[model samples]
Target: MKDNGSTKYDLLIERLCETFGALYQGVTIDKNWLCERFGIAERTAYRDLARLAHVLDEVSNGRFKLTANLLPSLHMGHLAEFANFAGVAHLFPHHDGQSLRKRMNNADNIAIHGASSRENQQYGDLMNSLDKAMTDRTEVTCFYRGKSRRLQPYRLINHYGLWYLAAVEQGRLKSFELARIAQFAATQIAFEPDASIIEELDTTSGIRFGKRTDVTLHVSAHAATFVTRRPLFPAQRLLKEHEDGSITIATAISDQNTLFRWLRYWLPDIRIVAPATLSTAFMKDLQARCEPTTSEQPQDA
Candidate 1:
């Protein structure tokens, strides 16, 4: 039987792992043995071994072993290359092999603390269903937020350590939080995946979907260095840097709350420059927040 979409990927991962395991044990493996062991075609086995050709050395009679240099330590470069081939390089944060290897080896030197993404175990079946639907270009029917939704499944996106399904419902691009999705089922109805939607998903910098508006801001000299040091917003662009150490930047935001929260954090150091309405609204909001509440009024002596 032909392997389904996710099964193919799973089988590939399994084959790669077993291949490395055998190589690590100093056992010589050949395409014929791999075909027999994995119940795969000889061509598929050849392709699998070819992916590791960079780190494998022939050991006579069509068998190959891990290059001697790689045996002393796990060669991260070769491993990264294999990961890239398997289409899982994005799963890792570091693109460079050296940095990743260092982090792996120097565990005691690093301190990591933050809200990490929840494991996908609960959504495994849902993710698999969506993956197959996307792979097959099929439509999906699911319940989102206690309402039935018919969507053209596009891509699974992870933003800010949360998983979301980016799909089209009623001809509008939207993101549904993975935790909220339920009763997902694939339909035989197939639809052509729009290239534009795919491009938008690839280009979108945040989970907030739908139309986006560009907001311009002025970063005072006091905060320019901090703002320029790293990207603070989605699709951030440095428009101009003034000689006085101040800078002008622009970024796209799909949700006003996201921008508002960011502005609140930066406070006086950052101010909206364009779309005067946003600036006016932000100032009004600040003034309202600064106003004394009835409960804080001075009581009669």
Candidate 2:
């Protein structure tokens, strides 16, 4: 069947513009470049550019162009001279108020303004992945660095303040922490996610964020009573109590941030037992902070 002329033209123009986005002044795009990049004819490329090359040259002044992912080996200006270019300067617009430091700090906040800002890179990545997963039902293989495993992503879950991934690689279902993940690339593999995934997430995951990992911590009266007195999170429940006032507190979470901060307040009372990851991080941070630091003298004084 013959190709549709309009569709072909649109495709050709799209290819040409994408190439133009990466072109720089010194580098001239030729027939061979078009063949290497798009495997199209020189005639087709020239035809596509006939209507637009003049405008592009006028705008770019022959400097590097092309917004395509690939970049040619043309030399961009040095770091100092980079800011001198109009195009580079437009990439960073000047704001009226707000210091740069304040802007940078806002970008770093994981949950800014209480709504979990997009400024946080990790939060953005996870939210994007979760959104894609929920909408597309695409299978993902993540290099999850949770204490349990590495480089495996079969699920998406968030806990208290942490992130988690669940997997059923073998027949066994397991949970992993998001902070442990190194990176992830969504796989084209499709799946019909099991209902158990949600069930385990709800049960094993904490009451708040759905991190499907839990620990039954051993506690003495100080912790048991304090838990009864104030409570760290609603997910924390008093499981059993010994006649000696000792108790087993079932607290679920993805990472140690919650337990560590809470136990730090408890000092010697609460003892974490089940999840070793939380325990290790807590001890490591505690050790580092406890080692006293040297004092510095003011030179001006």
Candidate 3:
């Protein structure tokens, strides 16, 4: 099959230009370097650079260098659009209108504006190593909760002020909290992750990658407004609007314990609508709690 080009080609060009900046004076790269860096054949390496041929000039028989600074200028124009999408353009402190325009015009101004999280501050190095492993498709070993385990990390997630790694351990997708990681190291062993596993994890909520349950809840009219305004879960959807002015919300809950906790918070305003077994368990728990204990027995002689 002849080549119609691929995103990998564009990515390779971008990575090369970014690594050895286009502004570098008399910088050159050889096909062998690209082959080693991108894990491609000599023919594949040359093919990947086909689209970037206009900006690159051949310095020698098998060597090439970027002859134009076209990429940075093109990337800079998308800064304002990206800032707007991120909703952090306003967070950038610009004293004057001109300064704001100038700062937003430069892509360097777009950054994660936040104080260092304690978890991130502590495990910053470990997280960096894990990120590198995930990017390179390398396996990692970490001691978590007194047990050492090997993992093929797929993705890193930050949810509710905690860092979690979604990884494949012993052929199962599991999530491990960074705080519980006692020791961490990236290994030289590389692994290819299945697209299905990554897609499943991406759609899943939080660090709970265990069995998921289809949970449904009913919210009273007053509380329904709040529920609709701010969904209980990221993937929560309104299944129906009841005639009694209530709303039926459905979400796939990975952890029933977590769902029960949330139910406790919305007590008077919300009720379980489906998964009768869970509803029964919750009622039994409530009944058990409400019943008088031996300690509350009458003290009268």
Cα-based TM-score, every candidate: 0.66, 0.34, 0.62
Per-residue lDDT of model 2, residues 1-301, tens digit only: 5569988877877886676553532234555666678988768756655544554442243232333333444333222144443123333354212232244457755333322422235566765775676567665565543423322234565444455556554445566555555556666666666676667655653423344467877888756776777566546788888888888878667555766777787778877777787678779988987876656434564
| TM value for model 3 | 0.62
RMSD of each: 13.0, 20.0, 12.7
lDDT of 1 by residue, 160-267 (tens): 678898999989899999899888888999998888888889888777876888899999999998888868889999999899989999999888878988999998
- Please give, for residues 207-290, the per-residue lDDT of candidate 3 as tens digits: 777667887888999898889976776479989998888888888887777787787888888888788998998888777877
Question: What lDDT does model 3 reach?
Answer: 0.75
Count of clashing residue pairs in every prediction: 0, 16, 0
Error of model 3, residue 219, in angstroms: 0.9
lDDT of 2: 0.58
Q: Which stretches of candidate 3 lie over 4 Å from their true place?
A: 1-119, 288-301
Ranking of models by lDDT: 1, 3, 2
Off by over 4 Å in 2: 1-119, 122-126, 144-156, 167-183, 207-225, 230-301
Query: Which pairs clash in model 3?
Result: none
